[model samples]
Target: MAGIKENWVTGVGFGNFQKAYQIYEKEEMIFRAYVNHAHNEYLELAFEGGVIAAILMALYLFLLLIAFTKIRRDALQKTAFLSVVFLLVHSLADYPLRTAALAMTFAYMNAIIFHRGFAECRNQSPELVEVDHNGDKLFVPVGASP
Candidate 1:
């Protein structure tokens, strides 16, 4: 009984590494919370929901493509359009949080492509953005919403 109490007090003696102990405790808490919320048919319902969402997003994209004309001016407009599509897909797939990360990545690539002002881009790093252009100075303005 005493040994069990000591183990409980120190988070099962994984405290030598504080980060590991914290991670273990957090995982334990998450497990407990999930267990408390468990429903036997939840996974089946979630799976069906995901399938429906995928079909819906597909149909939506198909319709949008049908609506686009050759005279359409901006590719950025399409990027924003697809971004919204992916966002709805994310929500319909039951993950509303994932879209933000994906949108950041997609927007970064779009910035490197369109806003960088180059027919052929040269180099990029995790921390630095660079491009090689002939005469055009493509600058994306601050506080610009798209």
Candidate 2:
């Protein structure tokens, strides 16, 4: 247990070091945090995970797109959008999704957005069909249809 905890702590420290190294690499090559050119955790993981990461990211994008367009309540829509932005911004610097606690929080936010979006879609009335004066078919709001 001690060994596992130490390893995780060291890994988190190393991950932060890689983020700092990327910033310093643009100006200098011998900075203290620069742990060679290969220690960047995010890039390394992306390379190692390959297609799995790509597919997961695609799904994440699709969820954001749907939530933004379909969420019925304005407040929930804004909250979900902000959470997505937060996850994206945080991921650029740290592996939040790789950490259990943070990952659970992310999953909760995603579930909320998806649930609300589906609920809104389900609640919408499908009785929008109408017959016009000349027997032509028309689509109008539920109460406005003749």
Candidate 3:
């Protein structure tokens, strides 16, 4: 065990791989974590951050169930499910970062989707509103829009 730790610490045990990535996994992680393409880490971090942010936003949306009148609240629920689906698709399916930037991107996009949804609810007029008729209040019905 100690020898293993020493080997890892010194970066000494790595060797050739049967294929391109088979042997280079650790090196790739290091490269992704440090050196060039440093943006990869940032991108990954941003992806995670975006996930956390989405969760918080979803929580806020769910809290206002009664406020939105039936239709609007249902709409809010659908949007929340959309966000969850986005998170599910991203976290599962095991896609690579370079390949799955699409997922990260979609997560980011969903954040905007929900944010704008929240915003749209806020901007609506009283008569035209369903999920947000309270005005400036959070969680108003989210299904009343035509």
Name the top TM-score candidate: 2
Give stretches of model 1 more than 4 Å off: 1-30, 35-46, 49-54, 68-71, 74-76, 85-94, 97-146
Q: What is the lDDT of residue 16 in candidate 1?
A: 35
List per-prediction Cα lDDT, in the order shown: 0.40, 0.57, 0.42
lDDT of model 3, residue 65 = 37
Candidate 1 lDDT by residue in tens digits, 1-146: 22223343232222232233343344435543232111222222222334453355467557555544321445665665566556545554354433477658655643433343332222322233344468765443343233
Off by over 4 Å in 2: 1-45, 116-118, 121-146
Off by over 4 Å in 3: 1-80, 83-90, 112-146
Residue 87 in model 3: lDDT = 51
Steric collisions counted per model: 0, 0, 10
Give the per-residue Cα lDDT of candidate 3 at 78.
Answer: 59
User: In terms of lDDT, which candidate is strongest?
Assistant: 2
lDDT of 3 by residue, 45-125 (tens): 223334443455457546433323332444554565566455544544333344466657555644544454565665786
From the highest lDDT down, the ranking of the candidates is 2, 3, 1
Model 2 TM-score, 2 decimals: 0.48
